[model samples]
Target: MNIREGKKEYLDMQIPEELHQRMNDVIKLDRKRRNERKVICMIKRTMASAAACLVIFAAGLNTSAAFAETAAGLPVIGGLARVLTVRSYHASEGDINLDMEVPAIENTSGDAAFTEAVNQEIEKIVNDYTAQAEQEFTAYKEAFFATGGTEEEWNGRQMDILVDYEVKYQKDPVLSLELTAAKGWVAASEERHYYNLDVASGRELTLSDVLGDDWKNIANEEIDRQIKERIAADPSASFFGYGDNELTEAKFTSVSEDTEFYLNAEGDVVIVFPKYEIAPGYMGILEFTIQD
Candidate 1:
């Protein structure tokens, strides 16, 4: 027999249907791999071209090697339109300068990337604003409290306001207050329980107490009412009261205790510490006040 012709050989090697399908899938995978390689190569080429352009631009503008490296390394930081100029000067010699532009950091989907970027920007803005506010608060402290300064003193008393919002905390809210004075000192911080309410509502509530009781775990059915009564009845004052040989002058007074619940609106509660007992050598008074 003569050697098989081209068509005969092709027909003889023809695969079964399932095998043919499998082969087709393999071919598709190979094609996909090749396409992926091509795209990667294109990206590499684009990045290299961009890096070269950036290097040239930087060199023409007298920017440094470090800046060029930064621009090349951080593609995200490199792609931004606005250039930030960083300069450093030494006492002995030459100054160093850098120009940086941020890149568009993107995620898998375009929308997600945009949203994440906007959120990051907002976070930055909030952080900057908070930092500025903290600086102002510090300056206020220094100007008012530093002795030998005649700046019109800012009430110079500690006023603690529970910041409700307009500021996002990175952590749990920290409770603190600062009272700065040029000549005075904070002796002792104290608190007392009292009551306040309006008549028309007939709904009554206890006023501010510095260390309010946590009645959540109580097993008693009337625990809340009992707490209100206990707090109301001059409750034996359990917190650092009446130390030996201290002059006492202040008293606890109530403002309002009404069960008019309002969201973020001021609640009816105010407790005032009028007279504070002073220990020997302690000239300033100790008082605590709550307002809502």
Candidate 2:
């Protein structure tokens, strides 16, 4: 896909109507499965990104299978070009169900050692989440039975955990990956992990890599200003401790190189705060775009 002026042109060509319809069907199927399983939250952003890749590949298949396969094998701009589901886990009992998609990287172009390091990191993250989910589910099951809840009742209580990843930015030399893990019953809790890499050197990029030495001061100031502006503009806008509290001060003033962030489609730096990290769970995931 060719991205021009912040818009993806999908190779600057038209996709056939039949292929477009098939892509739509795939998206619809994904939604249906999510609904049927009653997963807490949907990773819409990552799903959309995945859908686009599928569409692009599907369009290529229409021309020639060989060409399509070649294009699919092409390396992404910076390093990792292909994101595929390496593993999936699913379990459904009376009231509980768990589903997860583990993403893996392929066709990486970089120093062999560095590329392996990045891949290993991705695998470790996914495995950690999978382990946690399994542990939680097992505990829940034990507790349900101990509380006199019948097996049928246990089967009826529904919970879901999903994992997905998106290519946030893929410009030359810099590549950003956004990994999402979302879970919930009535409401969902979501967390995002960002990996920014300098492909040439096989080094992970921190906030300081993108911003300069004064990054802390600049980022904290911008975040504080935006937070105050949001609260002023809308009374409903709320954070954990906004007024006069050390907690609020600590949260707002502690911007560091390790802060979680990624470049959006518009190439804006976006700072992410997991649910309840800075505000109520109802606020979902909190994000602020650092103005350039």
Whole-model Cα lDDT of every candidate shown, in order:
0.28, 0.59
Writing each residue's lDDT as its tens digit, candidate 2 over 214-288 gives 878778888888888888897877776775423654355567666677766666677877666777755656788
Instruction: For model 2, give the RMSD to the true fold.
Output: 18.2
Residue pairs that clash (backbone atoms under 3 angstroms), model 2: 76-81, 94-155, 94-156, 95-154, 95-155, 95-156, 95-157
Weakest ten-residue segment in model 2 by summed lDDT: 37-46
Positional deviation of residue 69's Cα in model 1 after best superposition, in angstroms: 42
At residue 235, candidate 1 shows an lDDT of 44
Give Cα distance to truth, residue 201, candidate 2, Å. Answer: 0.4
TM-scores of the candidates in the order shown: 0.17, 0.65
TM-score of 1: 0.17
Give model 1 RMSD, 1 decimal: 34.6
Q: Which ranges of candidate 1 are over 4 A from the true structure?
A: 1-110, 147-292
